[model samples]
Target: SGSRAVTIDTTPPGAPVITSVMDNMGTVTGDIANGGRTDDTTPTLNGTAEANSIVRVYNGTTLLGSVQASGTGAWSYTPTA
Candidate 1:
């Protein structure tokens, strides 16, 4: 009862991938890349179909974050990575 053991994995995960938005029309004001989070800034949605809709951020089809346009017209996210 004087010995202990533990195991850990130290392999770094792959980076997230940024893909084209579905039906993306207007130029995104903030960073549109994967893991990109915007706050207090509205993306220029001149021709965007759904301006105030829940957009899903992903990495090679892996769901990352769901950004929603707030009352202040901004998107916020706290990435775990």
Candidate 2:
């Protein structure tokens, strides 16, 4: 055996993109540039993320919902009013 040094690098997950947000009317909206807002209290949110990563949806400090990205890095979540 010989003396050796090993270094471990740690990196956090990347931020998930809220690419699409659905309104209560079931209409689909575009990306965050769309502001992720709607008149309806309950709406579905869809986005892309690192595969298998957790995507947490929030409004200010309150958490709306959470979802896991699929192998293809696609995810969707809907919150209750």
Candidate 3:
């Protein structure tokens, strides 16, 4: 199957307030990469984007998974690798 281009309004959906992001080392920053290599293979990723929007977690170009933001703009994605 081929892919079709779906256009989405690139306008601001309001400033998404990412409150917290916790890992095995406790809370970390949001909207930025803030970790080095760790022994933990599975880590819980949490954040807040535009509510009801989809949040995709990625390592470089590799997409880990996607999580739907809650009604309160809260989202979490736990990686298997």
Candidate 4:
């Protein structure tokens, strides 16, 4: 329906942080100009992170939730509204 810019914090090496962020809830529809683009899917989280690392989803400096990283240095998370 609309676009939202997700700010990712990448600082304080000793602390858990976000390296990169993507725009959330963007419009993706199949139309005449787009040719074949559609909005039937969402983004998937799949990556490796350090143990005890915390992944936080935010809406501009507001901490949404904390996701604990796996013991094998892997953390995958999906944010829900």
Against the true structure, whose lDDT is highest? 2
lDDT of each: 0.43, 0.77, 0.68, 0.53
Per-prediction TM-score to the true structure, in the order listed = 0.31, 0.69, 0.60, 0.41
Cα lDDT tens digits, model 3, 41-71, are 5667677788798887778999988889999
Compared to the true structure, candidate 1 yields what TM-score?
0.31
lDDT of 2 by residue, 1-81 (tens): 899999876886688987777665535443433644566566677889999888888889998778899998999998887
Give candidate 1's error at residue 69 in angstroms: 1.0
| Candidate 3 ranges with C-alpha deviation above 4 Å | 1-10, 14-33
Off by over 4 Å in 1: 1-51, 71-73
RMSD in Å for all candidates: 14.2, 3.7, 9.2, 16.5
Candidate 4, residues 1-81: lDDT per residue as tens digits? 999999999865454544333333457532212233324333334455667677665659987555778786566555665
**Per-residue lDDT of 1-81 in model 1, one digit per residue for the tens?**
698787887865333222322222345344454445444233322112133556555559898667664543344443334
The deviation in Å at residue 71 for candidate 3 is: 0.2
